[model samples]
Target: MSAPSTDLTQEKQRFELLSQEFENSQKDYSKFIAARQQLEAQLQENKIVQDEFALLKSDAKIYKLTGPVLLPQDKAEATLNVDKRLEFIRGEIKRAETQIADCQKSLESKREELLTLRMKIQGV
Candidate 1:
């Protein structure tokens, strides 16, 4: 009947919309994963630098590369800067992790919605 046909058509439209949404969520999830990975790498590198600082003597000459110039830096100051950088990187990593987790949840929910919509379309 025409009523059944109408229901089928509506369900198909809904399925299409859900499919698009799921695709978009997948893209967002990928982006979040990339960002989280980059943040983790940065955190690891900073931790390595922090460890290196421990091997250096207090009076060791340290230089900071600022663009094209190597500026002399006091060891204490450099260590402090590295410590602050590590803290900031750790905070950023936590934030990225949170975003990744939230995006993963969104992706899972959208996937479920798409599957349900597919079933409805088939039934119609």
Candidate 2:
């Protein structure tokens, strides 16, 4: 009876410890998921900005050439304006690309953290 009682006590303690560890892992995973979602949103925003920039670049090219062909002097000024806009868009695209790279790094880090936690929990 004593042996049985001791075994039961040890089992209960082990169970409790395991439960606590599972809870902690759950919390950490939750946080990681949230961060991943935010990173995904930012990536999406970056993609949208990139798309917008591409469209703006296309518009600038079209207008710059058409303006010059149709109305030389007026088109020259318009082309200059379009060129300026294109330059601005290019700069914005570069910035967005940089941000995307940063987000990817953060996402990878979070994934690695989650994987490490899971492996630790599994006793691997």
Candidate 3:
């Protein structure tokens, strides 16, 4: 009958809308994942930089505090530069970690929303 046809059409439209929403969510999720990956890579690079800086600091400390007085002025300047760079890298790592956390949270929320939508669509 016409009533059944109308219901079918409405249901079809609802399904189409849901499908579109799902696709959009999927795209958003992918973007979140990419952002997380970028943050992680930045964090790793910062860690490496931090490690190198730490090694430079240790070397400078050994030369200044324990070794002979042959340490040159340039070495002292380089040590200060390394210290500043280490601090900057540490700050960058912290910011990247926060960004990664935010991306993870967004991804989780999107996944949950997608799951709920699927369940609703399935009449579960």
As a whole number from 0 to 100, the lDDT of residue 120 in candidate 3 is 59
Clashing residue pairs for model 1: none
- Tell how far residue 32 is off in model 3, in angstroms: 0.4
Write down the TM-score of every candidate: 0.91, 0.47, 0.51
Choose 1 or 2, whichever is better by lDDT.
1
Candidate 1: what lDDT? 0.85
Worst 10 residues of 3 by lDDT: 57-66
lDDT of 3 by residue, 1-124 (tens): 8996776676666667756765775676576567656656665765675466566643454233336555544455655755676576566657656765665676566567656656655667
Off by over 4 Å in 1: none
Q: Report the C-alpha lDDT of model 2 over 10-121, residue by residue, as the tens digit.
A: 6556556655655665565565556556555655665564455456543353322364474333434554664665566556556655655665565566566556655554
Ordered from best to worst lDDT, the candidate numbers read 1, 3, 2
Ranking of predictions according to TM-score: 1, 3, 2
In candidate 3, stretches whose alpha carbon ends up further than 4 angstroms from where it belongs are: 58-124
TM-score of 1: 0.91
Best by TM-score: 1
Give the root-mean-square deviation of each candidate in angstroms. 1.5, 11.6, 8.4
